[model samples]
Target: MPADVPGSRSERTEGAARPGGVASAPEGGPSQAVDSVLDALDPDRDRPANVIETHGLGLSFGSKPVLSSIDMQFGRGTITALIGPTGSGKSTFLRSLNRMNDKVVGFRHEGDATLDGRSIWDPGTDLLDLRRRVGMLFQRPNPFPMSIRDNVVAGVRAHRIAKGKQLDVVAEQRLRKVGLWDAVKDRLHDTPFRLSGGQQQLLCLARALAVGPDVLLLDEPTSSLDPISTEYIEAMLAELVPALTLIVVTHNLGQARRVSHRTMFFYDGQLVEQGPTEDLFERPTNLQTERYVMGRFG
Candidate 1:
């Protein structure tokens, strides 16, 4: 049986990973600092590939399994959408993919999540580095309290990457990528919170891009925005999927139909079904999927 997801758009997820050492060297200096890490983190043409793969991944809150025996794959340049009832472990499973579950006190997982074939569960894994590679956008725009310019460069600085004009260049380029450059181009020194909710969200996106991630996770990214803002985000998502792996969790099945390349339906903490978006939405392999999509339950 499929668990019914309430018809609406308000599911969300969290987390991060790191990329190569692009933070230490300033500007255009040798990207060599990241070389050592490249073999392990880079998506270079000849790299072993595979963005994120989980094996028998399970998690529990106080011994009550929140997620169970989860095995999944996230590939480059694709959009994977997580869908399910409000608390069916959809978000739980999503966070575990990047070890965000580790930050939840008392949250424990029985299996492993691997990025680029490296186990994230390893004691020696660098959390900050992992987060950079797996950039995340929250449901709300949570930009740091600072000049837009400063906020965008914060991740770069934290990663010990380039600073000053070079960082500014990266920030600007990312702003352009998110379609925020034209809106806030003149407000680089303005506080981020002052912008409209939608613009602030885009700024946060710009900040994420300044770090150049291979995968980006969006947790109900447009739930709080107006229709126009929602459309903006939806459109941006479509454009971004070609260069970055995107994992979007949403209650809005319509949004899933529009933006996701693949969709997974979850129920009772289990993945009931998943497949190419059009087929799943149009032909629906399972009865639960059919009911949920038709508003019969969920």
Candidate 2:
């Protein structure tokens, strides 16, 4: 695996090491671990601008096609929104990026998806580490059955990025980043189920961030939240860009307009249109895209 790729095993090992010590914090303390985590997540300055690319990608379950001939590139530190009516293959494409559909009963794919200029399905690629670099947040908040703090640091622990007191640092830093620290600080050990729907989602976001991913894949992230919570998540997303890439699958056209720099329209298993967010929404080149954006039909 390329050492420069975020979450690569080599980067993780090197970043977590002190001059003469193992892959853990030195005498400099938890701050060192925190800094290491952040450094590891940063994309290599000389890396290709497009963090992910799909080439003639297609998908099927058994013999039923889901997505076809989908070619796209997701620029580093940019947000692209996938938008379309239900059953339009938007979610399927999103899931394919991280190979989330591989275990489905009859999932099959064509062509390729690449990360950092290498095929994601390369024989040498490590699935667990690939998932670490390409994290995901689902349609609903699915916090683990653990304490709030534990929920936040779950990935960090799983990746062995930090441990002992360092886990606390990672948890607090991530929770604060997602604006959940102040709300859940007093109940760090309490079960996450007690949090409100919005709070739980934020907690999930924090958990995703703790692993220091290079790309984040979101599927209808704000769909379940109220207006206020939705606003909160949207704002948080805006703050993450230029540091982490985001690909979001959403049904809400308005949310797509608000949070994405680029937008793609998928219909009947084909990519109908894609362009800058403003242009795609305001001057859609395709008749179908124009109608859908104008509320003629989903």
Candidate 3:
């Protein structure tokens, strides 16, 4: 395996201590994870210059606030990991990016969240288009009750984006992107249940990628998969970050340390701290963040 590859098991911090040990932090060089992401970033590609900005973004469900005063900027094409204990509003914050929270009754928010400088809450904002641009993958693999090919191309087909050969090409490309095409190429017509648990999750990712999203919001996307499957998805994500901004919510501090370029810690509906992943994990500025990262509690 390449030394610079994200999730490269061989690439460990100096003194090579894996996260969660009581070992002291390594210093004097870029941490392994950040080095990998930086190496993977393309210098020649025309990346998104626009930022995803959230200002005073607070959300409440029937008078119960879940996210409060979140002012942050996630740069284009960066991989950001959201971490904290359960009920810290990580998932709620992710959903708000694409307005998924509107489904809840009495859900209201303050301030603004924007993708590429466009306000997502604008009355005239096309909800469908917004969602398509900011695609989401949930905790568990939720493949539709359909053939593999159909599931992969569902969104594009529904939006009338392509047909016949073009649709077929799209399906093949996305499946291949997620490294599932070879395994399922001959079984495209088979139902999703025919796939193993990992394959199904990769299929869901293909479904999301088929539509050409600008940002991929993953909510613990590998939580339900086996170790090997988790590895496959993490590798794919590392590859995808160069093309799209990725915001992932994962409670596994080790996973966050391994894969994210930046990390954000949330607690009781407020963002306590955020910065380069290594700094946040190895030397958290906030006491709460330090405790959480150290696995003291959640």
Candidate 4:
């Protein structure tokens, strides 16, 4: 396993119950378990290309389970849409990817979530650094209480990615990336709150990108924008793929089909189905997914 996972597989899995309620390894003893572990941990192991993966993932707040048995992988440089009804745990699963739920009251998780084949909850992992690698955009624009330029560079400055004249370059480049530079260039020093809601959301996107994240999480990014603004954001999102992975939680099925390469449907705390966007929409394997996608029920 990775350095952070620590302990031999035998040490971790010995005496653990196997299928059929077996209490321990067979006649070969723990070595059998060790061999299985080695196969799984082998660096040369053949597997699908993925930037983020979850294994039998589960989540709960205190005594109430909110999500269960979520096994999934997110391909690098691809956009995956999470579509489900409200309270379906889509947002919870999204927030868990960056460890945002760590501080929530009664939050608890089972199994593991990995980035680059390493456990995200590893003791050696730096929480701040993980967040930098997996940045997030929220349902609405939430600009900092500072100048427009300052907001764009807030994360950049916090991470010390650039400074002095370089900060100006970073801010402008990111702002332009989100297509907000020309509109806000004249008033760079003005408060971001004064900008239109759509502009403010774009500014937030620029801020998230300024840190050079590998994966970006968006929760209903265009929910509050006008149609024109929504189009702009959607277009910008398309341009970001194949460079940065995107995981979006959206209630709008049309938006999911428009921008995502793959889609996952969540229903009543379970991952009902997932596959290519077109396949999921046109030929979902699960009845729950079919109903949800066809607008029969949530």
Candidate 5:
């Protein structure tokens, strides 16, 4: 399940987890240069395509299995929501998308997960590149103990993507994308801890966006915020989908229906159903899905 988002629980299942680390460039200098990462964020890049796909995927930690025979697809510049009861492996599935489970002890998997048809599990895969293409935000906003400007440019600098004025431009553009630049523009040099929880979460979002990911993964991003903050995030997400793919794990079914173009329901480590958001909510093919969506059971 999730680590910091209180009340946003996850079932232990058989396996799960991942934390980020800097990865050396592949045979080449870097998978993407500073300018390329920045260019990815341009609003014009928004378009529909199958950006992520999983086939016959299965995962286990030690001997316990958390996911099995799962097949799913995520479209570029679209939003898809994963919903299920506690311990059903929602977070586990999300983590696997970016190999986040690599940090978990005894974690292993079978089957294929691809980004643009390239296997993510390949030994030659560039971890940093994968992360840049697929950025993630946790349930709560965990800002680095640094100034807002530094927080936004952390990834960019780590990868040596940009410098000087260009770096400043990246910071400003991402902050604006998340609607935090205007609020924090004057205080860009101030520490992030000084911001309210809502602002901090948005800051975290800006940090993720600074790298310009092709697919964005959020694990209950709004679960810890106040209603007003939640509204802000949801609105921002709507605006973002036109440029990057978004896969969100949320417990709030209402929120799922409100924000997703496609809805997926999981149970006991398996995907029970998935379809267009309206069709799934209005007419689920599976009884469990219907019951869950109807508030009959989680």
Candidate 6:
């Protein structure tokens, strides 16, 4: 297997000490996950970009701040990693990107998050459009109870993508992009629960991709997978990054250094610091960052 998985770690890293000396990362880079399939994105050489930006972004639950004054920008077509110990609100921050936080009755926040400069908080903003543009994947692979094919195409169906053959074509394309197509093609008529945990997660990813989102958000996406499956998803993310803005919140420090273009350190609901992955990892500006990354505590 080729070892160019976009975020391949240095051999000296402890994770590389895999049994039988298997490649610590996935095979042939993450690009292989979706190489043959083409996204429906229009080709405009000078088209404007779609970046996720926020300023003074803060969230509070009943007067208790969960995320306070976070100012960060995630570049379009790049992956940003949010890392910190437990209770740092990493997941909360990710959900806030799409106003998923608003679903909770007591959720309150101050500041604005803009997707491609459009304020997501503005009452005039079309929430359906915003959510469609910024899709999300959960930690566990929770595919619907229906067939694998049906699970992948749910979002497409929600938006009413064409019909019949058109939907099938799009579903196949997205499933193949996430490496689940061949595995489930023959089983498209079978129930999703019949597939392994890993495949279910990939199917969830296919569902997110089916809508042609500009940004993808993951919250501890591989926490339950075995190492092989974990590596597979990591590789898949690398392939997906070039066409989508990716923001990942994980407690795994190694995952951050491997796949992130920018790394942000959060502590106790506050952003301690953020910068280029290498810069932040090598020399953290805040004491909290240094302590957390060095394993003083989770």
TM-score (C-alpha) between model 3 and the true structure? 0.86
C-alpha local distance difference test of each model: 0.77, 0.85, 0.83, 0.85, 0.82, 0.79
lDDT of 4 by residue, 1-298 (tens): 0221112222222211121112344467687787678557644246335889999999999999999999999987678999999999999999999999999999999999999899999999999999999999999999999999999999989998899999999999999888889999999999999899999999999999999998999999999989778777877786676567899999889888877878999988999899988799999899889889999976
- Candidate 1 has its poorest 10 consecutive residues by lDDT at 8-17
Query: Which lDDT tens digits does candidate 5 get at residues 1-298?
Result: 1122222212100001100111233454356574356446544344324789999899999999999989998865567899999899989999999999988999999999999778899888898899988999999899998889999999999888999899889999988878787899999999899899999999999999888888899999999999888877877776575467789999998788777778889999999999977789898999999999999987
RMSD of 1: 10.0
Report the Cα RMSD per candidate. Answer: 10.0, 10.3, 7.5, 13.3, 11.6, 8.0
Q: Model 3, 16-72: lDDT tens per residue?
A: 122122124345466656544543563423433545889999999997999998998
TM-score of each candidate? 0.83, 0.86, 0.86, 0.84, 0.83, 0.86
lDDT of 5 at 45: 41
Candidate 1's C-alpha runs over 4 A off are 1-43
- Candidate 2 yields a Cα-based lDDT of 0.85
Between the candidate structures 2 and 4, which one is better when assessed by TM-score? 2
Ranking by lDDT: 2, 4, 3, 5, 6, 1
Displacement of residue 39 (Cα, Å) in model 5 is 18
Candidate 3: residue pairs that collide? none
Clashing pairs in 2: none
Ten-residue stretch with the least lDDT total in model 6: 12-21
Q: What digit string (tens of lDDT, one per residue) describes model 1 on residues 1-298?
A: 1112222111211111122213234444355555555545555545334688888888898768888888887765667888887888888887776678787778888878888888987888888888898888888889998999898889998997997779888788888888888888898999888899999998888888788888888888888888788887877776565467889988888888877777888888888888877688899989988998887887
User: Once model 5 is optimally superposed onto the true structure by TM-score, how far is the C-alpha of residue 131 displaced, in angstroms?
Assistant: 0.5
